[model samples]
Target: MRLRDLLIDIEPLRAGRDFRAAFIARTVSLFGLGIATVALAAQVYRLTGTTVHVAAVSMVMSVSVLVGSLVGGVLADRSDRRRVIIIARSAAALGFAALAVNAMLPEPRLWAVYLCVAWDGLASGVSVTTLMAVVPTLVRRDQLPAAGALMAITGELGSIFAPFLGGVLIAAWGAGFAFAATAVTTALTSLLLTRLRPLPPARSTDGGDGGDGEGDGHDESGSPMAALRFALRERVVGGLLLLGGVTAFFGVPVVLFPELVHTRFGGGDVMLGLLYTAPAVGSVLVSVGSGWIGRTAAPGKVLLAAVLVSGLAVAGFGLSPSVGPALAALVVVGAAGTVYGILEYALVHHSTPDRLRGRMAGVLTSQQTTGDIAGDAEVALIARWFNPGAAAVFNGLLTAVTAVVVAVAVPGLRRATLPAEDDADADDTGADGTGTGADGGPGTPSVPLGTGPAPVAAPPRAPAAG
Candidate 1:
């Protein structure tokens, strides 16, 4: 209720040197990736003068990123996480440099553009997953919400401005200059990562069997499939993953924006652009005022509430007869979506153990990408079959209904809470899966639903390139 509760918290950056470096590096890297995305699309279009060719390049990049994320998960759990990030980022920087050189040439080769983009996409996926996995090791359990809020802000900023900046650079100078700038930012990220302390995989952070289940008889920690197996056994994690997929599949109706604008509002290019930017503007506002998120006792409840709000907002956008109301609805959609994303992020990390964090992060990254891409296609098909407005209305209602269903079904998620500040090195979950109080007894109960036991400590409680 206090005014200070509304502001974004920067405690993680101030208190942890490793987190600070990673934050700065991540912010810069996100911008670079955004810039590269725009430049690559433009250059490919110019070279081939065909949208099909551009689509092909994008498909290639997506596939490469998918492959990289899976491989990165295994690497992150098996090797030094810090080294994984550094190597991945360095490779991306080199790819960007290659793109810059190709762009500046008298006759730029389209093949080279494809090759470099594929290379960059692979590297970006690895670095992104590894970075997400390593954050819990850098900060205390309670600081995760604040850290997630900061990450969301940076991602939104990149989404809002990086593409515009890339376009400006391309128009004023050339695509080559934009590519070169991205190359510099990525290289700088690699340099920043070098300052981090070596982070090795914790095979067993709490001396458990290193598995989430009752001795699954398989030490799957080093395997990418370990995340999948873990999710199957953990209902809270499974519910969270499903919540994310539902939001992505039914909540984000981006592909239908143009059709809705043209048919319902009789709008042109400018209106379309405004429609696109509205949600991001709303997201930035909420992220800046996200301080209260860290203090929430029932994060799972909040996440579900956000999901409901987001779905209803989208439905409102579909039902609105005029532009003013439509844009207002979109702003709400963005705000609610941001809240859901930030909470979901923190809860996932809190629930996961350090040993499987990397693989879990990779699974999340893949799930998000596949969800968004599949969701877009699904919405487009619905629009084609019926109408854009109708599609939005249906999807929005479906999303809202799914949230209610999840809240009722997943008690662990609904009851999940964050304990007050505990010891930095406290074991949140006991080996037998019970709450461990600050005095090493039962203090405040904050447990994830269906995860066997609540954390004795605190509850174990992207997507750009991810």
Candidate 2:
């Protein structure tokens, strides 16, 4: 293959300046969150000297994020998306600032840390969902995969480097400096958000074609519960979610890493840390070289293949007797999982209409969080019963089987294809200050800002049924 074909595609960033801004903002914000994560863990462990207290804070944050995602989804569909994101991120910035202040205190209170974590988690949940919903609007439909890949790269980079940076900062100046740094990054994200044009909710107001009140898309609006109902009712959407849930539920091998390192590999702390980081390294390599992801017509088939590969790789890891082979297996697992994730994100965005995008994204986020938490518990229990390797092998096989089952059950998803790009289009924005449609249409309908409500985009056609 050519070098260009093996590199990360930058077409989405080149498509519009707004997308560029969003991309940079997302990268910054994710890195900031990652840094905060390390600092939070260290501070909590220092204050309480118990892992249970750390877990308690994490649980609190998880619940808050869940609740915030639901509420944010509803608000995104009802209000101006840009406004909601700005407000949510600004609140998170404030929370970070508060954490900075608390860290600087002579006697840091554990309660203050918990409160700040909860606050940040809730705000992050809201901002992230709204941002996901807005991304498709900033680029052409065909650029979705590239956008997804780029976003995935940001996450991988953050996971790999932000903790190291956080540790360095803490060692040099203490946790207060790290917290202050995060606050600055959060504030920068909010500032970047302000540069984007107004993004009103795409749901129509009247009982018209895509109206939320009472029409064709009537059932689309309202709370996240309504969105959940819609997802279960929709064939392809439901199928995708089902497949994702299955993979997530069986995909956690991290819980077994400690036992495997101890008993199977006879390794210490350093080796265990290497095992934990191997997947992230693999994910980053694949994501950075995902240029072909956007050009593929058989994305659904590729996604299924990725899941199968991931399962087999995990099984291979579990079956490995030596460290070298085990690390290689984990690398393959990470690469395969990254492919699956990029395709899943693009497919979800492609399938969902603008009006319901936020709610659907929220649902996906919630499902992932819930699945990971549950999977950790389920796999840990299995390992406790049989053995770590046995649990890994069983879960890996289960995940592979789930992928095969989904392929057979969801034919529509299996045959899915992205919309074609328009060669004539230059960018998402017109010189006249109007926005263009994402579906290769001429221009989105517009209303003057401050005159009344911002104009909503016309909803696109629904996905093929499974």
Candidate 3:
């Protein structure tokens, strides 16, 4: 199919000035972050010459991101989302600047690197949560899946180019300049955000009967733990969080592939760059086709299939002897990863109300961070004992186990349908009871037993007019 036709069919974003501006800003920021990822890995390896140190950096960033996501979620629920994003982006810019200066110093301590990573992670978590929370407000509900696909495409595009560019920059102008470039891009992103009109903060409406409101209620006391508890109680939100954790656990080990190429395959920077590019190439293709995938299948099923496929592909990587085969395996892994990422975001967005979107985003981010930390530790330990290829096998096994558990335990999640745009307007009659829509038709089937109904079973309604 033609690209325009594909986009029209799948994309949820409206062609508006604000969306265009935000897209440009987000793209630039993602590209910069991608470059920084490669630069950071290279710098860490150069400093300590150990895979363990590289893993430690990832650990530090993950922990910081987890904490930041929690805090950011609480703030996003209360404050203006745009302002939160601006502040977070500004903080990231400053962190990049700090890293750039540290790179120039004569004897940069390892602790300095850790501190920079922490700062960057915190800013990144906050910014990401706020940005995600703002998405529903920008586009129509029917377009959310397409918008999600577009976001994935932008991220993959950034990943596809950044490693090669990072290597080139590092080789020509040192890691310092690479970080400086990140700072510049970050500043530009902040500027773009500044130009956008202010977005409304999430509103909390109290039900007349003193019952918990339609939206997730915010405890204005600024307690992160309370928000965490609320998120845990949300059946769909919690499920998505669990799914995200699984994805991170199974998928993030790919980050270790560069080190594998260096030590096991005796390839240097160029090979490392190619290894990073391999999955991204697959991701780009998958992202381009994600719109079709979303339309034809339930998101949960797509997510499960992606995870299972990724697991098998990763296992293939473990068995491959040559770099060519390994790269091909990575391509498979990347395609699955792309589909999984899109579904994860869509599920989270669908499950959350606008009021709690920020907190939900934060919760999701924290889960992802926790997963990354755990995955990194697991991979590092395995690599220290066995070969990197063996570590890949372990990661694949972990993914398979998680997928199986999710499929069995949360059968509702397997094909949980997206609510029609007006599902929220339908009368709430507790779970499992029939409710009528504004159009006097049966609405979403809410399963009280927790094993939700299929999406296709949703009541038929006239197609919404464009």
Candidate 4:
């Protein structure tokens, strides 16, 4: 393996101008969102003087994200992705501006903060779903791993900076400035997107339909129920969704951080800051060194293993008596979590046909957001009932157990094999139900697993293993 391959892949950025634009847009927007994330919690806490109120903002955001992603998925499947993104970004920017305005008030209305957050969450869900759907369209199949890697790295880096930046802005200036900065970044994203190619839904190829992508048949593909039905029918998709849910709500420890810092660690604000930043640091290190993962053919196995590792890491963090060990445990958790995300994105993108992509993306986001809120709630509840350490250990062990059970039970996902593009031109209906053109009639074989591809000039290859 050359040293260059070990570094982050840049072909996704190089091969497609649209991908590059979207990449930059997401990175910039994430930074802004990061700022908003911190500011929102701080403002809410300031106003209410209670952790519960601060938590409410996150809960509202999660519910709104679920609603938005569900609706946005259907829209992404039926309409122009570019347009959906533009509208979503615009709405989100406006929401941020509202936050800014609310912050500037002498006595900011608490309700106004929640309102802006809900609105922002709705638009954010739309933007995230549409953007995921648009990736394969913008770049070749081979570039997906790189694209996903880039996205993860950008997000981690943005997250690392945004909190500190928000703290500085809020301390030096105020929450109003942080909110305004987010608004500006969002507006800039919309402006940058003006040059990207328009993405319309891929019709017949989306979910095994044989017709050219058009007309009323498109309506069903755009439905959330349709996506749900497909997922139930496909164990691979269902399994991945389950894994994500487990990781989100059960494995994530965001809600318990402050409590652990104050009680278990006996640390103050500085220690709390380190706890928050540790994951991003680990994620960045793994992302830049992600070349090895793409070479693995059995990404499903790898994905499950990543989950197991994450669970164990969290368990270790829970048991660690010292801050240093806890921080080390966090690094492992972060790396494992990042790999899981990359593989999940690659595997899902590769398996779904063009039409169903948007809906699946929507479902993915919805589950993830729900898990986040639920996980936080559970951890907090557990802390209240027991101790933070016990909660962490319990969740971590449960997450690991869940992964093992899912891995053993979900045969389709467990045994599924991604192709190496040897028969890219072979005509076969990929188990994904996507149709392909193959002149070699009976001799041609479909993709080994249930995953499929639709008709396209260049056959849709297996998704990247990033």
| Residues 346-427 of candidate 3: C-alpha lDDT, one tens digit per residue | 5555444455566666766776667766777788788789978888888887787777787777766776665444543243
- Compute the lDDT for candidate 2: 0.75
- Candidate 1 lands at a TM-score of 0.91
After superposition of all CA atoms, the RMSD between model 2 and the true structure is 6.8
**Model 1, 136-235: lDDT tens per residue?**
6676667777877888888888888998899899999999999999999999999998989887766453344344333547667666776777676567
**Candidate 3 — what's its lDDT?**
0.67
Best by TM-score: 1
Q: List the residue pairs that clash in candidate 1.
A: 350-460, 350-461, 351-460, 351-461, 412-449, 428-457, 435-456, 436-456, 437-441
* Alpha-carbon deviation at 211 in model 2, angstroms: 6.0
TM-score computed on alpha carbons, candidate 3: 0.81
Model 2 C-alpha lDDT per residue in residues 1-466, reported as the tens digit of each score: 7889879998878768888888888888878888888888999999999999988898888878877777777777778888999899899999999999999999998999989989988997888778777877776766777777888888878888988899999899989889999999999998998988888876443443223222455455676665555455445667778878887788858989988998988769889988988988898998889988767767878988999889988888878889999999999988998888888777676545566777776776677668878898899999999999888889888888888988787666667665556531443422122444442224432211122222211111010000
lDDT of 4 at 442: 39
Question: Which sections of candidate 2 miss by over 4 Å?
Answer: 205-220, 423-466
Off by over 4 Å in 3: 1-14, 41-56, 105-113, 207-221, 224-234, 255-270, 383-387, 419-451, 454-466
In model 4, which regions exceed 4 Å deviation?
A: 205-219, 419-466
- Tell me each candidate's TM-score: 0.91, 0.89, 0.81, 0.88
Q: What is the lDDT of residue 128 in candidate 3?
A: 78
Q: Residue 113 of model 4: what lDDT?
A: 92
